[model samples]
Target: MTHPQIIARCHPALEALLPKPTAARAALPDWLRAMPSEAPAETLNGDPVRTLKHCPPFLDALSLGILIPLATDLHFDKGAVSWDWDPPALPDTLISRSPIALHLPEQATGAPYPLAVNSILKFLNFWTLEAPSGTSLLFTHPLNREELPFRTLSGVVDCDLFRDGYVHFPALWLDRDFTGTLPAGTPIAQVIPLPRSAPPELTVTTMTEAQITANRALQTDLATTPGTYRKRFRH
Candidate 1:
């Protein structure tokens, strides 16, 4: 099968200095790597059951697409944020020197974010992404990255049509007490390119006799088999 290509463009001078976007699989979190596939647990029969480490869907969601990493190390102390990145001199004056930006409290006055921080922070993306002609890019917080101190706001952009400009990510600072460095290579966003075709119409109906029978068989298999979905359903 042919795969669609996604391109990332940045200043030629900062090519080596900046952390390039990476595949989500290549950037799995440390906690995930340290987790065991199975641990001592109590099932109904007192047997050890599989953990999320052995779950394909959870792993697949974390490995879905490309991850856009922070270009520089971000330091947060008290309520202050700072970075220490010095990019090579470039002719383009439009590029941002700082790794982050801010949105005033008034800008998000009525927003329903869980956090009560006075301002919204944005990760400055220096790279421009280009997807296939008929696709858009879904930009969201890195999947299953709940350990991070902020929640990135989700957005969809017609990247195929809007590849000329940068797409910064806005996030709510969830931990005001978090004071440390978010390393330069930390993933800030996950980008998944999806086709622009409209989805099929929704249909609501009662299950047919065959469908009910199939559901019963599936349930029985799930109860009896350890890896039924992994062995037969997952591609």
Candidate 2:
């Protein structure tokens, strides 16, 4: 679909979260060459119909390590939100949903890129059960990457928190990219394994405000000076 189509069909929340779509469509292919282009599926009715999969053009146009601050602020477990100073806790599931991953620096200090949410929304919305199972949706950058590994998660928010222009997204679902062998037609996304990734014990202590300010600096660099940094994560 074209850029206009993406904007028109996307959730208002997504539009509000991203910067303007400034990357030219022509430059996208090379920037996202590592991401898989298709999700493998056996079509029903005994015929396979190749459906198009999507990722945020924003991500497609930039490297993964540019949007780090948002990712840094998204650490949560047991209903507590805090920053850790160890290696990040990237998500892993054994089922294959699609090929996608967020990049992180080998060390706890790093940044994130401003990727398109429409593509991200497409990847995570594969979940079948949930209040918003089939809605056109996307999460805030921090919430999507750290709080909710998969974007299609659904749950209720208290009206008071939601009414004041703030909402806490408690993730109950995620479309994890599976990297293991599996039987055919498994509907749920497979858990992606992370042997090469850092261990769970790793942590990075950070202040919320400081991380956000740092993250903004990185985003600015990504938009204006695409160079000045190298790839810090391994695929």
Candidate 3:
């Protein structure tokens, strides 16, 4: 039978038994099996663990793994799912409550979900594959991501060197519905990069030394002048 049909029928069965999936699967590490995505259970993969301990593990446990999509690891990290605006409080190598913010077509209705990133830097592109043109991707980070914090805020996607380079911006800026600006908490992944070369007619504009001196002198004269009408100064 097809996987979808199989999963549809089996979900009720799994929910009925409500067995301790983690305890059932002996092979997986504890973090791998105890994901809260499926049920009310302790979190897994928030940090490195000794081992996985679950019957099925994340998507693997769903409907006897009949409908578990290929590359499940890429779609869902071995951890919790959340929509928290606050930056996750994570150790260098740990899972905090965060989702990868994949840009997709707008939904028919309802607010969007929150996404998170591990503070530790890692290479996202390494984990990414091709997606449909309209499909924005959110990379679910496993707690293991914490262990290998990218030595830098690595980009999974190619970007402009200037606009996308290593720079720490304020977190408050991330929440804005930015126009001609990056989104709040916008990760290194989904950046709208700038061009590398200057335009033919490009020119640098700055206040001249003469202008700066004139402005400073004007300010000083105003501060020193009396409140009453003052005599005009000779050049």
lDDT of each: 0.89, 0.29, 0.27
Task: Residues 84-156, candidate 2: write the lDDT tens digits.
Answer: 3233222442322222233222221342322222122222221121112122222223211332343322333
lDDT of 1 by residue, 1-235 (tens): 9887889998888788889999888889899989877777665466666789878899999999999999999999976888888887666658777789989878876877765467899999999999999999999999999998888899999999998889999998998877899998889999998999978899999999999999999999988988888999998
- CA RMSD per model (angstroms): 1.7, 23.9, 25.2
Shift of residue 131 alpha carbon in model 1, Å: 0.3
Q: TM-scores across all candidates?
A: 0.94, 0.19, 0.17
| Ranking of models by TM-score | 1, 2, 3
lDDT of 3: 0.27
Off by over 4 Å in 3: 1-51, 55-129, 143-146, 149-235
For model 1 the local lDDT of residue 80 reads: 83
lDDT of 1 at 4: 77
Q: What are the clashing pairs of model 1?
A: none
lDDT for model 1, on a 0 to 1 scale? 0.89
Candidate 3 residue 137 C-alpha distance from true site, Å: 1.3
